[model samples]
Target: MSKLGIKDIAARSGVSPATVSRTLRNPELVNKDTRKKVMKAVRESGYTPNRFGSSLRTQQSGNIVVMMPDITNQVNAGIIRAIEVEAQKTGYSVLLGDTQGQEARERHYAQMVSSGQADGILLYTHRLPFDLDNLTANLPPLVNGNESIEVEGLNKVMVDNVQGAKDGVNHLVALGHRRIAAVLGDNNAPSNRERLQGFQQALQQAGIEPDEQYLVQGDYTTESGMKAMEALLKLRKRPTAVFCFNDDMAIGAMSVLREYGYAIPGDISIMGFDDIRYASLMNPPLTTIHQPLEEIGQASMRLLLAQLSGKNSAPQHIQLPLQLVVRQSTGPAPESD
Candidate 1:
């Protein structure tokens, strides 16, 4: 039996060999029906294209770099897992770049694309690394995942933070809480900034004025949540409800609440964003706005793949939907004082 090759796939799929090659290299360039046929033929015949030889001929790298601040975070892990799965479907490898919140480290990773080591970049950050500026003459495609950058002309896949926050806060408002507060993460991050805006908007809509003192900054850690909760406790008139930027922060705040002998929901209703796995396993399960991490990653990969295939269009912002998961953490606001 002859070894299956591109020609065999083309013959089996009823397409030219060039079409089979194109579909294998950049599936997005081939029409859906044709791509499907070629893929089916390849699968049935167990034909694996010579990726190394193909890369050399095309002067391309079958690799994509995914940059993120922290890979240890469950949220980041979930998104990257999905991105890898999606990239693998198209014969591309994903290179994980943990920036560790350092500028130099980020620049080092960005150089991979400019140096022809990776085809493109997927970012979970607000700024394109400075090193990429030198490659303006031939910058590879970039797709932002979850986090948003200030630069224009880059596609993004993220949830609507503003709307998600509003929905969470509105839930508290509906529960008759007037003295509401927020434990927000890094204000520099677009998602956190948008969530803060949403919290304010929800308050305004509920006829409650935004209180500056109630808006505390957190670094999106459990420790930051604890400190934010401490600061709120020091206020002359403490808030009856609080919303956290993420579940970890919420867990931090909850721990402080317990230390000070405050009852969850009974004394203060708490809410959070980014429904991580542990959100439901806390002493009192947390109610949070759920960001579809997997879907966001998949969308980001698809956007980058489209650009890599020369499917040009205006930059797209694919905002995925958010769900408000209600659990044991929140309840009706406590009766006045």
Candidate 2:
């Protein structure tokens, strides 16, 4: 029963101690075969590096912080899982911080870099504070996933919200839905604004005038969705179909519609964005725009790792595509009753 050290693993793997350390700290820097050999040797030798000792030697915490606007939202769960897997592969652990959509909390988590608690940060939140430029300047390597900000030297992995919204609206239009209402997210976020603009673009392409009365804003919450539905129902000219900015709101709206004795697709068609896991399990299932949550997570981590390894020179802005998933929630508008 011998305590294994870096030298022991390095000798067993026929590599230098520095190589072993690099392999443990950042495997992406090593060739895949070399990394596999190093890991196998470490496992066989029962070598576990002392995190405290390693941190002291490298002047790094070996921790990454991920900040989510709302952790309870199921849409972020997949991304978190992906990040966890990839971060583990890089010998880094993740600390999750839920900001609850609060600017102060977001700023607090972002400040961890300067405090030396984390080596990097991953932000998946709505619009950051306007002064985020000054904040990001002092932070360690930061990457954005499922959200966008205009800060320089930051990497972003985002889905094409505009195209996704346009596709969602086009599907409704094809199903004979001309009077379409929209339940949009917060107007302050670029993603929400892009979705609204895309929805409007689709209508304009069809020669349909945009109706302000059919639009309502939500905070991307289920309760907001319910309230928006109530408001939309009270409009003088009710829409025949409704498109929600996200699946959470769409599900909320659907519940309210059912409680009001309205038949789904029979009275009004409903569609949502972000095809979360529960979207297909709802009573009637949901028609939604599918975002690659897992892929976004993986890609963001890769980008951050690249930057950390000094292999990536310029900031990268990646926009993944979206798919329209048609389920039982949407259909042709019912004939006038």
Candidate 3:
């Protein structure tokens, strides 16, 4: 059977081809009654609009692309769900792409924007290629979600990492933990840097000097967390408390500590960031900083939609607030200390 054509729907709907095209590309330009009529006629006639041709004419794919460093992380799941919910409300669909934290994979997705396969791109990758500015010049409007990259004119939605980290550390300090260690995510990532700075600031505020020997770096992975814990345990005077950049790493560190016969919150206190779903389910619930993952996702989608709608609004940099959720993982410093 021959494929359905636009002319068939246009003829049946009593609308011109140009009107049908506008209805598909910019539905807002068409009245509600006309759009409903056109949509019904198209659906009744089994008409599938040629998105590729429409994209070529209007420089829009009618689709949004979302790229994240890792898709399996629980935090990322919340973010994706939020973005999808908001995107659906605007008559847009999202194409999720995972780069697995590789520069080449990130660039591949970025190139999709230039090719008109996506109207805009949402990036949650960290340590993106340094040449992002050069690449951005050739792509569609881009937005950062939960991760900041250095690119002028690009909008961003992030949480207050520094303040959150400081709050976590101050909580530990208040619990009488003086010799605190940290398992950090990628040192180069902006969020990690901010968190580390906040930790240092909090220590200084408590009249404690930053101890480099107690700090270990990880890649925000459970395995890396385990390794970092191993290194931290080798310290001459092990920390009485440990702060992790994220829940995954914190959980990893906890596993290692348990293997080494250290009782959580009894031998050493532990804290984490990004209060992921599993944070509250561990043997000893994790104490963590709650980042508004869903809100960040919604905000990023809203920003992209606003740009697509030709709203001449200022580029936005939304910094959502963070909260500290205390639980079983953190307690007063060990009596032995």
- The whole-model lDDT of each prediction reads 0.89, 0.87, 0.87
TM-score of each: 0.84, 0.85, 0.90
Per candidate, the number of residue pairs that clash is 0, 0, 0
Summarize candidate 1's per-residue lDDT along 1-337 as a digit string, tens digits. 8766788899999999999999987888999999999999999999988766677787789899999999999899999999999999998999999998898888998889878889999999767786555544555688887778766577888799999999998898888889999998976788898998888988998999878999999989889999999999999999998999999899999999999999998888889899998998988999999989889889999999999999989889999989999987888988877
Q: Candidate 2's residue-wise lDDT over 1-337, tens digit each?
A: 6777888889999999989999987888998999999999988877889777777777788788889977777878889889999999998889888998888888788777777788888888865533654665554787887768766667889989999999999999999888999999977677898899899999999888888889998978899999999998888878999999999999999999999988888888999999999999997899999988889888988888887777757788998999999999999977783
What's the true lDDT of residue 314 in model 3? Answer: 69
**Clashing residue pairs in candidate 1, if any?**
none
By TM-score, highest first, what's the ranking?
Answer: 3, 2, 1
Candidate 3 TM-score over all chains jointly: 0.90
Q: Once model 3 is optimally superposed onto the true structure by TM-score, how far is the C-alpha of residue 124 displaced, in angstroms?
A: 1.4
Q: What tens digits encode model 3's per-residue C-alpha lDDT throughout 92-145? A: 889888888788888788777767778888888864433654755643677887
RMSD of 3: 2.8
Global Cα RMSD, each model: 5.6, 4.6, 2.8
Model 2: lDDT to the true structure: 0.87
Between candidates 1 and 3, name the one with more favorable TM-score. 3
